[model samples]
Target: MPEAHEDNRPLIERIAADIRKKIMSGDWEPGRKAPTNDELQRLYGTTNVTIQKALRILKAERFLEGRAGVGVYVRNERPQTITPAHYIEPAAAGQSYRWLTEASKRQQRGKYRMLEVAEVTPPVEVARAMRLEAGGTAVLRSRIGFLNDQPAELVHSYYPIELARGTRLADRRLIPGGSPALLEEMGYPTRSQDDEVAARPATTEEYVALELPGDVPILEIFRVVYSDDERPIEVTVIAKPAHRFKMGYHIELP
Candidate 1:
């Protein structure tokens, strides 16, 4: 350990470095319990707060996880692949694969609350993407998605109004279960969807609506759905909390 200094490095940083070295050197393995605060205090002669700071740093670095009631344990393995932004094709469509519904679990951090829905004039971008005439009206569905009961994602879905008009679906409050499965039943099959991911700072609306931390980045997903003729019919934008969603994609190489 370097000599204790007053000005330069933080105690947590130094301790984190030492712990990292031990793991990198194979002194500790995956799934191993990290030294508790008491153990760390004994080993390093540090206070509980200092040890906790070090552990929190390691956890943010993906080196450890706390199991609620259980002790902090090392991650068993790093994700084999980095999450990628990709399109999802539903099975009823010609696409061979559908996203596993089993994998899509609702998080309690944010409440999935619908804000509003109404027939609105489609914006130029939406018109072009959905192949609708300018000045055409579409059904807009807006919702606030929460994590840990905290707002996290602001979701807005637009569909051609004719398809959804006169139906109770036009009212956001009338929707149930948070999934738009009714569209499929209406015969406008969602064959496939295209997703685009971009990194950017959160806007003020996002920060407040999603209840995001100031320093955390946001993952923006723009998804376009195509119909049987390959015409884009719907557009949905998902503003997700940075640390919450683990996106992944796979590609087959010949």
Candidate 2:
């Protein structure tokens, strides 16, 4: 057994780690039902609540899944194999977020559903994320993006159009282009960012766009991209069917 952490780890995290070890070591094979809560409590010497907490973490990480009325089981695909951990840098082929954002606003070859595009007063969190004063006017863009007529993803993007003057973003034709690239072209290049990813249930819009059944789960990604000058510019909330999309990243070690 590995030495325990000097600091007490969260019960869920510790349980999650042990379960991950079993899966990685092939002690638990894909599609195999993990031990029951009572069994886990015995094995880990913990309470049902602790076991549930751990299982929830695994579920969120896509390592395991629960069926209604059925017990938890290892995912059909090895989580490591299906979970996206790599990011691919698109060819420096001149991408523009403005154009993409605008393109998304327009109806292209793929089917689309615009939830709402009303100018509204942003909440404090939105204002903080966009670096704008609270209650300021902003454009709320919510739409379902599709490929081959299949719902690929749902995008909720907020922009400070009040600050973006003399740009194409206001025109709403942004497509096949990237919003980050567009900002760069408009003299507000995105230099760095913070992002978070987790598995979640489909919202009403997501279900309609993805044609998702009640049981199907979706992946949610929250991204905030900013400029080198430390100014916040874009906050995008994305939702996609689990198997329909993949996230890629490339990291270099020093």
The models' CA-based lDDT, in order, is 0.67, 0.67
* Alpha carbon deviation, residue 210, candidate 2 (Å): 2.2
Off by over 4 Å in 2: 1-116, 246-248
Highest TM-score, which number? 1
Tell me each candidate's TM-score: 0.58, 0.54
Q: Tens digit of lDDT per residue, candidate 2, span 1-254? A: 99886948887788888897777556889899989999999999999999998888788766788988988998775432222222212214453333233334444334455666656666576677887765577766677776546566788777786645335544455433455555666677766777787887777777776777434578888777777677778777778776434455666899
Single out the weakest 10-residue window by summed lDDT for candidate 1: 94-103
Clashes of each: 13, 20
Where is model 1 more than 4 Å wrong at Cα? 1-111, 174-180
